[model samples]
Target: MRASLSIVSLLAGAVAAAPAPKIPFVTATDVIPAPAVNARQSASQACFVIGSETLPKEVSDVAAALASSVTCDKSATTIANVPDVTSGSTTFSSIDFSQSSQTALQFALSKFATANPLADTDLQTFQDMLDVYQATEAGIRSVGGSLAIKVPKFFLEMQVSRIQTAQGNPPTAAGLQVDHLRDKVLKNAPRESKDLLDQVTQLATVLS
Candidate 1:
């Protein structure tokens, strides 16, 4: 217990005062490689602070002291009702689920060109979307069944719209890093996922 407390005290100063992903978009593995499949899962399921990788070495050390008892969430239906951030729409009612999530996201981002960085209210809006993404990721993973793979598309689709949103305000260093991580996921996204994300007819702004 004393050892754990000491690690916590150390991290209080090690972690940055600014927002997360401050390191230009490197995932947890980049901060420090996971030892094995189960070890990686343990780190993944640990508390957010331990898993955040915001402080890299400091966080990795802290994670070693804690045991991950939490299980990965596999509830694929959890994201079904969440409103689309782009246009505030919901189009996932069909059986075939044919529409692609990557398509919606790409379309939205295409409208982006970097104007001004997000500010004040714009930051809040960005944070709201981020909260949803983080929450969804906590439970969803590549190891899950087919349903789990399909569930995250909605959130993925909204990101392109965010690029539209951020671009209108213009892309900041922070925003660009966010985009980088989003693309990494999209590129590595698991297969067999059905139709995901809401439909958008207009530009990203059309929905935002």
Candidate 2:
């Protein structure tokens, strides 16, 4: 009887020690979260910049133009409890945004990729989030080819700079204009740049 009790105790201990089931990813559909911005507006403007078949090789100058055009503006929306975004076992909060642009972007992508064979969750939302990821990756890769990568690449650096300055760590806010805010803000951006614009917009919700 003592041996049986000891075996039961061991099983009970093992059960107690097991890790809790991980939370599933959150979806835009499930909870849009608060502080959502006019990402589509930025996206539209970016698409115009991307319309040229061959982007100019001058990365810094062109990127400055691209970044300048995508001034994120806040839109009024009903505030909902900010849902903690997760993908598979990875929570959105777990991803690092403080690294180099490439490293940070890749890290974010990897977290989402690992979520494949996704747990029982809405696939559409995951795919949409993934599109946003790929868009940033595409824009980064496009630097040498077509898309002028430095633009998205700068977002990472900008976040770092923000951390150093006052915006804190995150790339979404249009930042205070010590002088005056620039015009040509995102309003009717094309579909192509939507994903990248979205990634930037999403960062503001959590990091800002």
User: Of the candidates shown, which would achieve the greatest lDDT relative to the real structure?
Assistant: 1
Which model scores highest in TM-score? 1
Write model 1 residue lDDT over 1-208, tens digit each, in one string: 9999999988886785546774666766776756664444444554332223332342233332332422223323333322221111221222112244544344323322223342212443433333334333332332231234222343343444455454465444553343443544444444323322122212223323
Tell me the lDDT of candidate 2.
0.35
Off by over 4 Å in 1: 1-77, 80-104, 107-121, 142-186, 189-208
Predictions in order: lDDT? 0.36, 0.35
Per-residue lDDT value at 163 in model 1: 53
Q: After superposition, how far is residue 116 of candidate 2 from its true place, in Å?
A: 10
Prediction 1 global C-alpha lDDT? 0.36
